[model samples]
Target chain A: MTQDAPRNDRPRAVNGHAPDVFKREGQVPMREYPKNAPVDFVIVGAGCGGSVLAAKLAEAGMSVVLFDAGPFFQPRRDFASDEREQEKLYWLDPRISDGDDPIELGANNSGRAVGGSSVHFQMVSLRFRPEWFKARSKLGYGRDWPVDWREMWRYYDEVEEALKISGPIRYPWGPDRGRYPYREHEVNEAGLVLARGAEALGVDWAPTPLCTVSAPSGKSPPCAYRGMCKIGCSINAKQSMLITYVPRAIKAGAEVRDLAMVGRIETGADGRATGVSYYRDGKWRFQKAENVVAAGYSIETPRLLLNSSTAQHPQGLGNADGLVGRNLMVHANDAVWGEFDEEIRWYKGPPSMATCEHWNYADDDPSKNFDGGYSFMSQGPLPGDFAGTLTSSTGMFGDDLLEAMGRYNRMAGLKMVGESMPQVDNRVTLADETDELGLPRAKVTHSFCDNDRRLQGHGRKFMSRMMRAAGGKNLFETQSTAHLMGGCPMGDDPETSVTDDMGRVWNVDNLWICDGSLMPTGGGVNPAMTILANAARIADRIIDARFD
Target chain B: MSQPFRTPYPGYDVLDKWDSPSFDDQTREVLRARRDPPPRRFLDPNQFALLEALCAVVIPQRRPEPVPIAPFIDAALHAGRGTGTRFATMPPERDAWLRGLEAIDAEARAAFDGRGFCELVRPKQARLLRSIDRGDCRAPEAWQEMPPQKFFRALLLKQIVQIYYSAPAAMSEIGYGGPASPRGYVRLKVGQIDPWEAPFGTWEDQA
Candidate 1:
């Protein structure tokens, strides 16, 4: 743990070490490894899944090396209050977006730096609804996850404790879980507006379950409500992977190599994984390992597998069934904004402060037009993003845009995380073009189905009604997407999935896949908590099967 | 056009907190650099002048000194700071901007007796822009492979709006609490305003 506190009410550093990094009290220094030497495990992508798995494996007396393509940022120095400057935190490398309804990538979904999307993600932590795991078996649509929801629930509790999540004492949704690790954050006007709408609509609402600490925890301070959660949190209060698992992994003798882009997973004639070839410091080098794990999330994971085609696995390491990049899914994050006469000042706290999962219980309400469901939350967007929203949504410019923006403080919005159908056509393939690193870029193709369109339409109408009921005016909707998933789904049948329940690649024994890429269905909730929980479960299975 | 685009929070300047605890040193540095226009690297003098005129139409400013939106966008393009992804049919972001600007000029010259976009009046310029926004522009050759509406929506309007709103003056006009760091907001209820936060209405007398 870091030893320093906020001194003189001013941040100490501009860009190097964290402000709290006076020393790691009673902790060992971070481990380092030689390139030619073989560690027990070589993990790709040091973000939510990779960082957590590294910490777990290292704690179990395993030598591990985690690699990320982006720089390991020190938040105090790197995170700027300005939105444009903070764009550095996102994956700004070129990717080709195509298909009928092409999804806009970056900022909303992908991240580049060490903590990955977690560094800039709005810290809304939520567990997957129990029925979501058995979507096919219980709800009769989408694929059922290989893992049981009951077991996943226990892992969710563990992750909440580790991250010190702040939430309501008794969550009003899903199965009865115990209290959160910390007290709930104070609800701002945006949240109050959401609560008013929920009460008018006669639905349950609660303080958002967030990874950000409400009160001081360990070396970190409480969140000051700077309202820059989606940007990099400079205060170390957000409890992102940068402040949590990454440090633990380092303390437990794991070597994290950032600014190192892994190009391919090296394989041998015996059909077992040997090591990884990565580029760093203007040179291409190889790091030998006993086992290789690809935790590069949705797009990069499948891209890495497809790019690493070998003689034995000509189609890709885990693409023998051609399911590696199939079924790419994204949450339908459609939003409805309205103007109120009262002072709404929506940018006062963490975005998505209050949320209602009433619509997510699809079984309870059989009147829905779609198989899956959605949940709506109050939003707190920064001015830059709000201006962009108004411009895109209404095509307002000059005087009209200025008039709309004059009421920025009086405007509030509700955004939904609606579930979209996972179709095989929505997949990531290698584009003809290459990136600055001379690697083939990912070409993502996606389009919404009729069911998804209906769900979105329903959500917009419902949210508009709620806003109007709560004394709002001039309501409008904007279509968007967030939290990319699928591409390497974990399922029981190897023919239909890329990995098994434990994220182990079906055909490749020594290779594994972790992160959001392994999710079979994109649940109607933020996937950060679920992703971290899944990573924890995978780490345990790996530990148990060490003898093999 | 409507009420002359009045600011609700008049005289509430966000830069008053420039030296305050609310902004960290790096944030202060970034804002300071943004205040001054960087040396032009990407666009030539003619293209740069056209960009300035186009940005003014996208976001009209009444201040004595408007925020430098064109220079920042040019710098971003010079550094190859694309939004990471683009439409498969469109060229790179830089090339698209080049084509779009050229098309705007072509439309202006054809419509207004061989006059360039910079030489046109405000109403005429806005009309040409609206034509492009509606994809009704007849100058197809100037647009080349890029669609006029697509270029306008994806690049021109988005970048201009983002750049304008990111400035401290625009944030202040919108009554945003610039950057909350050492001292964050309290009293978060409806109609509640912290001491340092900009009030909802004009605070000109107080200032």
Candidate 2:
């Protein structure tokens, strides 16, 4: 655990263990700055959503201030150390949230640095199933969303173009549709084996759509196929916010103030947002803006609104319906590993490069009572990570055991990423504890429903069958977890939601909540692309409003 | 036409320097204090000889140069201090493992006499390893502390691969050149939309 020193002239230690720094806590003198200078927009949390919003708004000539609690890190300067040290400082150490049992909560590995979770993610760029938007209407699980798939699809295309996402367009299993031209990667021996296995099981597999820039992309180089996608990519192949959206926002004249933590949102008596108060450089600073955007993730966004108490709305900002932090949903996932007779060299490419979506859509058969479809994640971890994850469940050691480690380099594994239904009980709230910075910590209370567990078990069985068909030896099941979402859901009815269809707060006219918090349901695919697309759509709506 | 890949980022040169270790006076002292003679389980040349004999029977050298298992065991035991806890438990599981190997050697000596475990030829070594792998060894204490089969699985799957995957020769075998290799490639085409079908059906179907 490396500690960051104060930005002032203080000699810092390498491992960040300085007692004097902690002892001098809360002692920076606050300098009074004019709070009268106003900006058109203030976007909190400089993640994928906030950064994209900043770039689009700044390009439209609007004054935008982007705030992120994490410190600004220049990869060349800050991460110039060896991969091990860089991972210790920028990747491994700060990622795991300080709490009891952080790993089980999915908080242990999520990034809290300047780039947000995008820095540490595997860069698997996938879109939601078109039917996901209508899950509520189809299954009678929740309220229907105000907009349809076509509205979101238009924004998805805009985001894909903006982010320069490149991948194969055709489905690997079904008949060809007249879509965009597809790009393909030369399947490695391990992927070929998995493909053969899937074929043997009468299933289809294909190259995955990764956010990485392949050969000959301008400014971004091709993936060296190091299979270290979870670690911060040294090469600019992975499309993290630092490389993609944040840089473009900076170039468009948006001021991204890193290390700036927005503590509270101040609302006016007329039910409008006045400004936000933040802590930076160990001093409280107030920034006044006509419009406020909360993109602080599923947990923090709602917590921010709920924490902000105002005279106009005593309960919280835009909490008339009392639905600020409710209806949280996370994807149900599980994995299966396969040992083969021949060497597969599974750790040769990205953590994931292909997915099989044969079971993604839910069947209409009432007797089945199936939860949702599942995607086959055929990517294996690097040797070190693989060994750690594989041996975590089994107790193996000694000389003979040493020989098995050699065989692991050639092992391949598959994971089932399935969707869980939106449950109101599984949610995020403010815990009794507070962080070192004197802010209430976000506490997540989540558990899989019976349906979710059933889906997971079924997915595991399917993956096992696929591996067997692929001629895998010594195959077995692995554990899985979920990511929190849909706490402050967006809907047409102000009675049941916090944000409107355009992501604007129902009562607070100028304030908006972006990020996964506004998602009414957890889609059956990775949500990064959808988050960016929605952010782009909301930014367009804000620009069209022409706020003065 | 030779097309050089443009430097990915302008400030990436600074990362090269960052990657290089800049040892100061204090770091040198810490390094000196940390340095010690390898423990008996790792340093004894007989341990490497035994490890080589066992790995040959398990994985078997497919081609010209089989994986050198001794270095992996030595490094994993050394590196395991911080990265892993399997070897650092009570009774020192690694030491117990070494004791298990010694027991196998004692059995071999009892059968063959006056000769080291490795000197008894390939068939003898294979027979000894297979017995240990199958938990046919005589030491009940060592087996109770660390099961032979479990230990064999860990040794073969974790530590051995850690060493092999890191070696340049081993990497060349799989045609992998790490993330920095210049041979990497990604092919991109425009107008491609995702083909994943909708997970849900139409409103009429639901009705």
Choose the strongest candidate by lDDT.
1
In candidate 2, stretches whose alpha carbon ends up further than 4 angstroms from where it belongs are A1-36, A76-109, A172-182, A310-315, A362-369, A395-404, B1-207
lDDT of 1 by residue, B85-203 (tens): 78887888889988888899998988888999999988788888888788787678898879787788778888899888888889998889997765678878886888889976742
In candidate 1 chain A, what residue range of length 10 has the lowest lDDT sum? A1-10
Error of 1 at A545 (Å): 0.7
For A155-232, candidate 1 gives per-residue lDDT tens digits of 998899999999999999899989999999998889988899889989889999988999999978899888999887
Fnat for the candidates in order: 0.72, 0.07
Cα-lDDT of candidate 2: 0.60
Models, CA RMSD each: 4.4, 13.4
Name the runs in model 1 displaced over 4 angstroms. A1-28, A362-366, B1-3, B202-207
DockQ, every prediction: 0.55, 0.05
- Against the reference, the lDDT scores of all candidates come to 0.86, 0.60
TM-score of chain B of each: 0.93, 0.51
Error of 1 at B179 (Å): 1.5
